[model samples]
Target chain A: MTWDWAISVLGILAGLCTTGSFVPQVVKAWRDGETRAISTRMYVIISVAFVSWLGYGLVIRSWPIVIFNVLNLGLSGVILFLKLRSAPPRRKEA
Target chain B: MTWDWAISVLGILAGLCTTGSFVPQVVKAWRDGETRAISTRMYVIISVAFVSWLGYGLVIRSWPIVIFNVLNLGLSGVILFLKLRSAPPRRKEA
Candidate 1:
């Protein structure tokens, strides 16, 4: 196969697999209604990174990069939202 | 700023933030000495993705992409390693 074609195939396969890593976590969080294990800091940082990537993609006029990051950002945002929402209620004790 | 420069800036910023997402998880996994919260399947998938990204980067002759994904792949690999190592032992019950 041509180098470009080979790379494209590799890219598609790898992208799908790595991106899939987050799927189980999302499902678990959704199913059990608990996100205690999820880290808020992580989400915050990731959101920032994804936004940067989106900006980069836009600047370069690369639709694939932009679209992928946009979707990733959305997914990460959902996890962050759930994590924040599920924070344990603070208690006032005498 | 030129579009290329702008995109580069954005790429760096976003890359840092999104990549930061995995840090806490790694630290937590390390600290707790437990990877129960981590998903092996997720790691498997991400490793695949990172490889693809690397291939894409190489194909496109993008050094930044290639370097970044290589590092990301390594980081992801570490997590996958730990998760796999910490898998709970199966039990046979009467």
Candidate 2:
């Protein structure tokens, strides 16, 4: 019983750290209006991954996974949107 | 039994997507040597989170979590190192 509680606490803490970590990135991107150093591919892939994780969470009926992925999706989406928006338009080859 | 396989597949897929997503980011960061748009706070927090997750995985005896967190720690560390290295020297307050 006590071990279960400890495990649960650790899991929750880990989840919060991973999920909430994106908050600062989002804030920096939004505030600075800069994403030159940020990786578009990373966000793109992670966004898709979050969707998969969300599906997995739903199938497994794990609320923590579902919640974290939902939040992650939102955060990742914002960064991707900002990065894409700020990107320089590609020029056609002469 | 089949359902068990399906669940396992979904879990693996989700794990792969999240873990593999960082590859592009690392590649970009290495090639460009830029991290201005990235958030130091996010990486710092996520690095700590990865450690926590690693610990949790160990306690739970989950190989996937352990492996993923280890990979994440390495990836996140590189980005953090790049970001910090590229950071402009802080000016002392008057």
Query: Mind giving the per-residue lDDT tens digits that candidate 1 earns over A1-94?
Result: 7776876667666655655667777776777777654567877887788788777778778886678777778877877877888898889897
- Report lDDT (Cα) of residue B65, candidate 1: 78
What does candidate 1 score on TM? 0.83
**Please, what are the lDDT tens digits per residue for candidate 2 over residues A9-94?**
99899889989999999999999999998888899889988999899899989999999999999999999999999999999899
DockQ of each: 0.63, 0.85
Per-residue alpha-carbon lDDT of candidate 2 for residues B1-94, written as tens digits (9 for 90 to 100): 6998998888878888888888888888889988888899999999999999999989999999899889989998988888888899999999
Off by over 4 Å in 1: A90-94, B92-94
- Rounded to one decimal, what is candidate 1's iRMSD? 2.2
Question: Highest TM-score: which candidate?
Answer: 2
Model 1: lDDT equals 0.74
Please report, as a residue range, the 10-residue window in candidate 1 chain B with the lowest summed lDDT. Answer: B12-21
Candidate 2 lDDT score at position B21: 86
lDDT of 1 by residue, B6-66 (tens): 6576777666665667788777667776766555777777777878878778878888778
Question: How much TM-score does chain B earn in each model?
Answer: 0.86, 0.93
What C-alpha lDDT, on a 0 to 100 scale, does residue A94 get in candidate 1?
75
Query: What are the interface RMSDs of all the models?
Result: 2.2, 0.9
